[model samples]
Target: MSQRQRYAIIGTGALGGLYGAMLARGGHEVHFLLRSDFDHVTKHGLKIESHLGDFELSSVNTHATVDSMPACDVTIVALKTTQNRLLEELLTSPTRDGGVVLVLQNGLDVEADSAAVVGADRVLGGTCFLCTNKVGPGHIRHIDYGRIVFGNYSGALSPAAVRIAEEMVTAGIDANATDDLLLTRWRKLMWNIPFNGLSVALDATTKQLVDDPHAVALIEKIIQEVHGAAAASGIEIPETMIDKTIDSTRTMIPYDSSMRIDYLNRRPMEIEAIFGNPLRAAKKVGAEMPRVEMLYQQLKFIEAMRCDTC
Candidate 1:
């Protein structure tokens, strides 16, 4: 393979920890910029358990803040959508230079937001297709398939993006760089928007949501609305593709959506990033999306409830 490049993971949670650990174990120089959990992670390294297998790294580099991070070739940002502002601060800090920020976030607008801070040339778009969770400090549980679709949003295929994808594949993580990164992000959001919100609203698993005929039809309606909104915005998502996506989810392990997990734990929800954006896009293009609007409002109300409880 190519010479091992220096890399850093900005968020040491489920997705970050799993990918970072695998890359480090493959002998790449890897570092992590974490928050308050740095001490525990440093002392014990990262532990990953998956249906594929389980493993632990004996020594993994970690820092609590960006001020302490060393210059690296690339930084994979696995932060939640709500933490985008904080990520902007970290990316703009002098500690990062001559490096690309690969965003492994859930939503679609991260590329534009990151471009505002670090310029479009330094930002790469990526979407992770996996079901994993940080079960505890230093422990991550991988629930299903792991794949990454990434590329430069400006349409210029950068050498860095290609190299990163190669390294990830070499480390046993399925990854590919695409010229149509925006479509990939939108496709992932199509699944995340309805299922995530409905799961939170009903306190159900993916299987539970699909099993209820009424809930299943509701999800299909939401998908149709999203498909319409996307087409209106000049992003054409075929109707048949939606059915294929739902079929893919059926094979995934029965698990609670991230939104439900966050709600149960009283953490901030990503309603705005996931649901609100598409609705706004629909409005921008003069498309009506009443069902999407309703779901978005419901998720917003849920967010307000969580805040009030806090």
Candidate 2:
């Protein structure tokens, strides 16, 4: 592996732009697979402002379509679940080859989706713990800690994974490769399933949701339900993990969940991938998820209404 791995970020949104800009600024050869806004990004460059600091990149390689992009060693996918079909197109397109597709998406089904397109050996499970959003075209505004966790789903950490972790660390972002990749993914889901629904349903911030008595109780109920479902499915999640998630939310009180932002902006939400997957797993385990199911239905209805209005 070379000291600097060539990186291609698939979705140049908030988290993707942040990390891509960081790697490019750190002297790595980075390219951004963008959409129709490629000309705008190319003209103005990518900008990122965060609680940790601020940085900008002036010479970012931007591609409007994957068909025009060069083959890279690693491709980081930061798209929402609704965009998975598009990702399928990219992975199956002639432009794709033997590169590792690191999915930094929310929800638990990223591996399954990516594996269907690219082989399991080429798919990596990744989760990003950060509060970030696009404040403008080609600009990402980060609000909290930015750390990336990734690993192989087959329980084997490849040398490529290690090299990617080292490159992320060199860019001043914390990255960890773990043996228990599935467990880490489920843990992150536990946080997203409850908090994301509550944030969207109530239009509340992380602090407000975790601080309110009724909201806190609701979140706890959802967490316990998810934990029960996970246990039934043969995943061991520590009891203390729920409390730790709550504490983390307390510190990130001002931060708004991505679901909330998506709802406010009238964008498609990840209700199915984030909430529906766990609900289905719970059903498979014979565990009841009344509250979680109710929220899921509510979000679906909300999304329907948004579409109807448009």
Going through the candidates in the order shown, the clash numbers are 0, 1
Give the residue spans of candidate 2 off by over 4 A.
93-96, 308-310
Error of 1 at 137 (Å): 0.9
lDDT of 1 at 104: 85
* Colliding pairs, model 2: 207-253
> After superposition on all CA atoms, how large is the RMSD of candidate 1?
1.7
* Root-mean-square deviation of candidate 2: 1.9
Give all TM-scores, in the order shown.
0.95, 0.94
The per-model lDDT (C-alpha) reads 0.82, 0.83
lDDT score, candidate 2, position 195: 87
For candidate 2, give the lDDT of residue 108.
69
Model 1, runs deviating above 4 Å: 93-95, 308-310
Writing each residue's lDDT as its tens digit, candidate 1 over 161-214 gives 999899889888899998878688788888998789888877788898887889
